[model samples]
Target: MTETTPYDADRARFTRQALARLVLCDHAVAVADGAAGLVATENDPDAGPGGRVSQAFQLIELAERALVSAVTYERERGSSWAEIGQYLGMDPAEAEERFAADLDGWNTAFDVPYRLDDTGLKRVPQLPTAAYDPVSACARLDTWAGNRLVLVNDEHPVSSGLTMAAPKP
Candidate 1:
């Protein structure tokens, strides 16, 4: 049997929230870059429109993933399905149904953190890369949030603070 380290337990407790914030931060960065690209294109007469449209499509996909992560975070934090449904303009049952699989997968990742690869020599994490390696996710999300959120202190940003608050199992 594989033993869970103190670090592994801590990571399992907090990775979901960190990953959610990471996705949101990534989406925000991409949106900012897309806006800058649009401005640059506006000034250049030779710039084309198709690339921007494609970028917009990609942003939509990122936004969808961010939404899923947000829902997962909310569920983990004990938010009611009705509350989520209210915000999403859907029935509570529908909201729960829509996100059930995502929440299940998130929970399962904590239980089974990794699986043997096809080669049977390497292990692949069940959680998303950002969630699997939470230290990097915290650093990235905290830096991004610290730069953007006025309430987030530069020295101790949101994600780092959350890591400190991870629940003991």
Candidate 2:
């Protein structure tokens, strides 16, 4: 696969992907909100307790995923665990543990091979999430980013007793 592309084209592609993701997220939130309302009101037998229970479960899952997404975004933007902990009214260690699922999802989403800098910072290139191939893409990233160690940090699933590895090149 060719990596070279005009900057404008790359930006346009990124814009489209981002917009799609945003729209989907908005729709999910709206659905979850509607479910919340339904669960709070109405008792029609056709859509009563059972339906409400199902909707409530879905809302919980959606809320969890949203929390993960938000935490991951904040972490990527260079927010420290202490900063995030303050925002969540928790200690740094508690915050890390609570957001473990979020960190795991973020790690999987961006698990392509990368070479971390001296400060454990890797300038990750924006890749299209569409048709994402973690294996081949990580191999390509290794070539582009060189051989450098990614650090064990709060964003890693390893912090939560999970292990991850870059795909074989």
Candidate 3:
């Protein structure tokens, strides 16, 4: 048997993929907005306001990605998300959420806690929430963001300890 290899798709192919994604996105959004539930528009449906919004959002994000990729590749063509969104009749947030799941590359960009600039001001990205202090502990971020907080201060959890009893036989 012959071994299989991965196939690479270029810009045109990527663009077609993006368009298809937009139609699906619009369909999802459309189902949400109208008084008619999703079933009403099941088989053959018209994409209405929500669909229009999603479509615009998709174009906005596609434009943004194109501009970003162009800037990375060509360097002459460059634009920000805000600019692209403006051209697409949407906003920065809309453009962002349109490509929300596509935002995998910049994940670790904010992972570093602090940075020292030439001016010597330290930039810290993470901040403490009601659940846990960002100043200490790695576990806190997960714990805090995951559920409702029973204890609201540093002392509560830090001071918390379990009293051991005999294990049931």
Work out the TM-score per prediction: 0.72, 0.44, 0.21
Mind giving the per-residue lDDT tens digits that candidate 3 earns over 57-164?
665565555443332222112446676577658897786666544433222222332345668774433211210121222233224323334555544332132122
Model 1: per-residue Cα lDDT at residue 38 = 58
RMSD, candidate 2, Å: 17.0
lDDT per residue for candidate 1 within 1-169, as digits (tens), equals 2435335744666645556555555555666656556556455555465766776777777667778877876776678999999999999999999988988887887788777899998777777656666677667766766776777556656564452445565
Once fitted onto the true fold, the runs of candidate 2 whose alpha carbons sit more than 4 angstroms away are 1-43, 112-169
Q: List the residue pairs that clash in candidate 3.
A: none
Please identify model 3 stretches exceeding 4 Å from their true place: 1-45, 75-169
Candidate 1 Cα outliers beyond 4 Å, as residue runs: 1-39, 42-49, 116-121, 148-153, 160-169
Best by TM-score: 1
Best by lDDT: 1
Tens-place lDDT per residue, model 2, 26-106, is 334445565657644445566855877777777777776556655665675578899999988999999999988646744
Q: After superposition, how far is residue 133 of candidate 1 from its true place, in Å?
A: 2.0
**Clash number for each model:** 0, 0, 0
Candidate lDDT (C-alpha), each: 0.68, 0.48, 0.36
Ranking of predictions according to TM-score: 1, 2, 3
